[model samples]
Target: MLYGVCYYPEHWPKERWPIDAALMREAGVNVVRIAEFAWSKMEPRPGEYDWSWLDEIIALLEANGIEVVLGTPTATPPKWLMDRHPDLYMKDAQGHTRGFGNRRHYCYNHAEYRRLSADIVERMARRYGGHANVAAWQIDNEFGCTDTVRCYCDHCRQAFQRWLRNKYGEIGKLNEAWGTVFWSHIYNSWEEVVLPAYTVFPMHNPGLHLDYMRFASDAVAEYQQVQVDVLRRESPDKPITHNFMGYFAEVDAFRLAEPLDFASWDNYPNLHFDEKADPLNSAVQHDMTWGLKRQPFWVMEQQSGSPGGNFIFAMPKPGELRRWTYQAVAHGADAILYFRWRTCLFGAEQYWHGLLPHDGIPGRRYEEAKRTGEELQRLSGRWLGTGAGAEVAVIRSYDNEWAMDIQPQSFGHRYMAHFKQYCRYFYDRHIPVEIVSPDMPLGRYRLVVVPHDMLTHPASAAALHAYAAAGGTVVLDFRAGIKRPDNRMEERTIPGAYRDLLGLRVADYGSLRQGDTRPVTLVRGDTAAEGHGGGVWYDIVELEGAEAVAWYASDFFADTPAVTRHAYGSGTAYYMATEPTPALMDALMDRICEGAQVEPIAGIAAPPGVEIARRTNGEKDFLFVMNHDEHSATLALEEPLDELIQGVRHAGSVRIEAGGVHVYERASLRRD
Candidate 1:
């Protein structure tokens, strides 16, 4: 396991490395990612390099018993590169060429840019390639920024044409998919199609822009590959990684994960979003990291505590910070890292703190970091290399997310909300879920949860229907078949593909809004109760043979099927018509849970400010229980456990105090 920080050695003395390392060691961190933006210090002039600064920093840290994950400084082209080879600068789609100013500004498609950037990468690796402390090599930072600022220069235009030729094989096929015949948008030649997001609102066809988005993502990967391929050639023994921005739709992570030796990402949430974040969002995002290689990756960046001001208005009422951190570990992160180990003095991000606050006082922020560090270190090794095996798998697709967002909603559709609600339902259960690719093996789990049931790949959909048909339960949510791959809705109420699996036709899909919820009554044993109403989380299901599991009131569709269960083949399928409240989701999930015989880690509670997660390495399991809440609850633990953080080995369940964290390892697995 690796808990690390993005450490900067510049502007600080060599002694600073030791202090940070000691602090990190106390926090259980064994890795330090250095130099994503150290170009100015590493290379003083064009075609010339300086190793004195980086050398000392690397050596000092290595000698102090810390591992290093070095980075190529190509993310931000040095001021000199831009001044001399201006053509190497990136030209935006709107046709504005960028000058050297911000990081990740290089035009990925530019010949000169790749050549210069590749040279720096080769040079950097050649120098530190042999260093024993270097565990991995990170490529340049986040790839595409303002999606519209992509290169549409002559180079991109020419390449885009050739790329189109290879993809569609002819302009006719491309024209048909993009609906170019409409609005006089049909192209006579491939050159007409431009990259997506080049304009605020696309005046042309969306498929043209959609294809461009896919192409641009691949282009960014091509740029990352330059650094990665070079590093592999230069240092064959070291693992290679790059930090991806969390939940970023740009630059496909699944495809990009293919080139790297492993995965890592930066987790920055909407400030108010921390608490509001559905647990599945974090799970899905982190699972992307874990699922990339199906192994534990590093936590490259997290907030130590709340930022002083919110992006809008919500504030982290103190304990929320701790809850968020433990949540990461619970999901399968081997380490916990923040954006900076030390606070910045002047920058767009200077306001964010590290282990120390900007005020440099012995105040609340520093104490929280120091305390968390000590707790992490104490809990080290006990949970390292642990795994949280999930019995339920969620199917997520990059293409699906892309396709869903591009369509205009005639019915006021919100993709993000629907997906979040569905995911959160499972997340609240602390259910370890494997967010598999659309085609990954489906039999390893007892069930699967699919949200926004649109564009189910032919083979993937078959496997899904087969899962339910084979007696495995499935939860399929909203707009499941509203659109085909062509982005056009079929006239049918349900897709012909999974007719038997669902056993019902979605006659109408009413908006399942948060405020639109009405009183819903449960129908299962002792489960019968009147609960809250969710306006439209799903739609109206006209039962072909499925039983009416629930209904609506106070509308023409009142007494209509809002929820239904269909026994198809040897299995069962549930179609939710509208968004159900948390109570309803739990009730529905419980039935599936009973059938699957799946139980979450025992005696677990994600109390208001506290979060719980289970991790396992083989059969040696450990439960991470954390209290991010200021006011503590007497947390009951699942038994026959020993405390890793406190180094206290005990049997059976125990109580966790406020602002407290406990990592309980099974006694039999330990020799200590």
Candidate 2:
């Protein structure tokens, strides 16, 4: 595994370079990422280039036995290029040009901006492609940060029209697909089409809005491909990657990662610190990143300290940083690189702390990171190729997320929140899960949980049907398959395409006001419990060929089916018509997993705040047990295992302190 920090050599003086390099080497950091936002330093003029400063820093780090990961400066184009062609700036939805005072201001569709970005990337690749010290190349910084992915400039408008033309083949087909007859918005020619912006009201045609999102995502991916082309030609041996942000759904990450060698993500969990939810949320993001290419990934920008630009964040107390580092590794990250080597003294990110404080002294955070590095180095080769072995797959779709964003039927219906809630259930039970794309094959998974897939493609619907038919259990939440791919409501019954597999039809549905809920009674065998439901929305189902496992006990839909189970072929398909309380969700998952024969990691019954995940390489199993609580947790083991971190062997039981982690390796799989 590669362990390092994100270094900004341009921020410090020349005399401090060697000191930083030596300190990093002492801390067991083998790599440093530089030049992501140093465009101005690289090119003082339009065509003039300077590599002296960067060259010195790279050479110094190399001498200290540290490798380098060079980032293309395309994220922050030099002001010289923007000043020459003012049209290169991105125009916001309100028809205002976002000038070059900040980063990510260039429009992806602007011809001049694309050419200039490719030119700079090509220059960087050629300069460092053959350097033995350069380990990998990162293509641009966070691709869609600061809401820059959606541009409404004339360049984008023209490009969008051409994209539509290619997708639909003709204006008439476009009209048909977009259902433009609803508002007499039929187009006569490609020139008549306009980017979805500045409408009479806040609403744009759903179909048009959805298509625009697709176009924008494609534009960004196309822009990255241009840089990827240059890098492949210049640096064929070095791996190319882009750092994706957590919970960022504006662009299709799977598509963005398609052309790269592997995927990496910037994890700043401090920005989303919740005592109970943080671990599950962080694990989901890590798994999502790994699922991008289904391979081991790197934590390109791991939060080192309290990250702040607009608002200050809570500090990671004592062992929290170490815990978070291990958390990332436990999920699937093969490498961990803290955000920065030292806190900056000036700029908007001056308050964003790093491993070292502003005084450039190694402090608490630095020492903790050093200890983690040493620990990880000790177990390097043993777990390098192992990956998370998950039997449950959670399906996530950008199209569905975008559809919900365009027209979220209820005020409390958030696509990502609902999706994460399903993952949380499995997480709480210590069941390993893999967040996967809807288009991927589902045969490898024993259970598939799809939450609120409002806009479902026919291919995805067919895949789910086949999976269930082939003895794979499927659990779908409310609003599944209500709309077509064009973001138009299906003319058939509610849960249109999924009705056959679910064996039920929604007779009626309504959104509940905030703080209002109806009671739901669920029965499993002889056990029955009453739980609250419908804080967001509720659907009244009239069963056709399914059994009602749960029913509403209040409201107009009282006693109607709120949850159902249908025997479809050799497997079972379960559906929940409303959002259930935490207790109810846990109960439902327990029942579902029992039927699916999916067991938690090693079948170990963990405490409430303890998390268990396993990584395996078919021949060996490595179990990562984490304690997220404030108190110690003692877990009973079924067999003896070798603890790699402390180089100790434990059997019967293991004790972990608060915010502690343990990695146990065994030669045979526990499930086997």
Candidate 3:
């Protein structure tokens, strides 16, 4: 496992390479991703290519035992290609073939684009084919168009027709699925099937336009394979991948992960991670990354200090990076990586800081990186094959993600938001969890929490029923049933016979005009279901035999049960009529989380925005405490926790600075 970061030659002089390399080595950064956007130096013309500079740079790091993840220079295609093959240029949604200055401006569908990019990849593959230090190949950087320019060109149209024919077998079915009868949108042949870009169709149909996005991504994946095909011809053993952004709706990571050997993601959650986000919600990304590849991966890009997202992307406080890095490792990162070794000199990212500051004082940042490096060296070879052996599975299906988004709803109806919230609850419990597709088996876990999984395949619905029949608890909630991807109701009410288990069916749910508090109080104050489970709730249809455990006290839907508990065979199904207020969710989650006998993570009473995650890999269990608070806070732990970054040990008490992170490791516990 190696820690890596991208170091730009243009950002620093040639003389700075060795000193920077030494600095990186001292901080435990064992690898460097080189040659991103260095097209001017690598290729001077359309046909003429130079690798001398690249070779020397590769050699410099290899001499220091540092691995290199080579990035293809196609990200910033050479000016020669841009000026000569203008057709290869990407035209924006506003209808302008964007110039070479900005990144992500290349239209992937152009003929000249494929030919020129192939030539560049061919040259790099031929030269670096035998380079030992080159660990992986980075295909064109961050592939996707941000602005809403739907590429409705002839080439894109033809490609889209082919993709649809393959997916649906014929245009008749496509017409039926898209409800083409609604607007006389029936197409007799594939020839009329142009891309849903700005020109060909109005930008109104996001569902249809979003399919065009899938086609565009397929085009990009084809380009990556073309380069991978060339690279393998030279060196077949090397793995090739592309770095992805988390929750990056632009290009679906699930689709992109199929082509990659493994996956990498850039995490730069702007102002919101601290605003009101669950701590474990942050871990979903890293977990998804590792699950996509089913192996450890590199933390491709993290802001050293402040990102470009917010007006002030907010500096990471003391130990925040360290805590976040360990979080990455705990999820599945084999390597610790950052976006840059030093700050960018020019471009829009100039303000993005790095390990060494602009004031030429590498003071605090360098110290932190060094400390992290030392910790990695200390826990060397500790978590090689370790993973969170969670018996629980949370289903994350793309079709479900889309269906949840498609239903005409307000802003809070985000699918990932709900999944991440419950995920945070499980993370705090030190419980191992896996995010599987809805199509996967459900029998392995005692509890399967289906958070807002609103769509269902017939087979998926059946599998879930089988799991529940076998005594596993199946949880369903608001927005659990909507139309299938084919624009038909798979099941409007949690589908697949879940109404029997859930004790209710959701007809339709919407916001209440007036805010009401229907507090959940215990009638007996001693029974298991008696605590604060009642609250302002989502109203829905209650089945005949279901018990009204919690009811709404006020709102138009008053007297309508907001929450219910149904007993089917030996198992129970819990349903929340609408999104629960935080207090209600917290109390209910505690009730459900009690299904497990293990005690929760103890010790910690700090300000809001603080998150704690505990996970075990190897014999040792590690706790990640992140104080997203503005000022410092003290943490008290009963477990013997060792702060891996600095040599600090704690039995009962520890001090955490504001926005700081702590990785506390303790001796392994063997249950057997």
Which candidate ranks first by lDDT, i.e. highest? 2
TM-score against truth, every candidate: 0.88, 0.97, 0.86
Q: What pairs collide in candidate 3?
A: 93-149, 150-197, 390-432, 520-534, 538-578
State each model's CA lDDT, in order: 0.68, 0.88, 0.66
Q: Give residue 178's error in model 3 in angstroms.
A: 1.3
Segments of candidate 1 deviating more than 4 angstroms: 13-29, 85-100, 145-155, 196-204, 269-284, 305-324, 358-378, 408-413, 491-493, 509-514, 518-520, 523-531, 603-609, 637-640, 647-654, 667-672
**TM-score: model 1 vs. ground truth:** 0.88
Q: Give lDDT for model 1.
A: 0.68
Q: lDDT winner between 1 and 3, please give it.
A: 1
Count of backbone collisions within predicted model 1:
20
Model 2 ranges off by over 4 Å: 273-277, 524-532, 670-672
> RMSD, each candidate, Å?
4.1, 1.8, 4.1
Better of 1 and 3 by TM-score: 1
Report lDDT (Cα) of residue 541, candidate 3.
61
**270-339 in candidate 2: lDDT tens per residue?**
7854433367778889989988988889999998988888777877788988899998888888999998
- In terms of TM-score, the best-performing candidate is 2
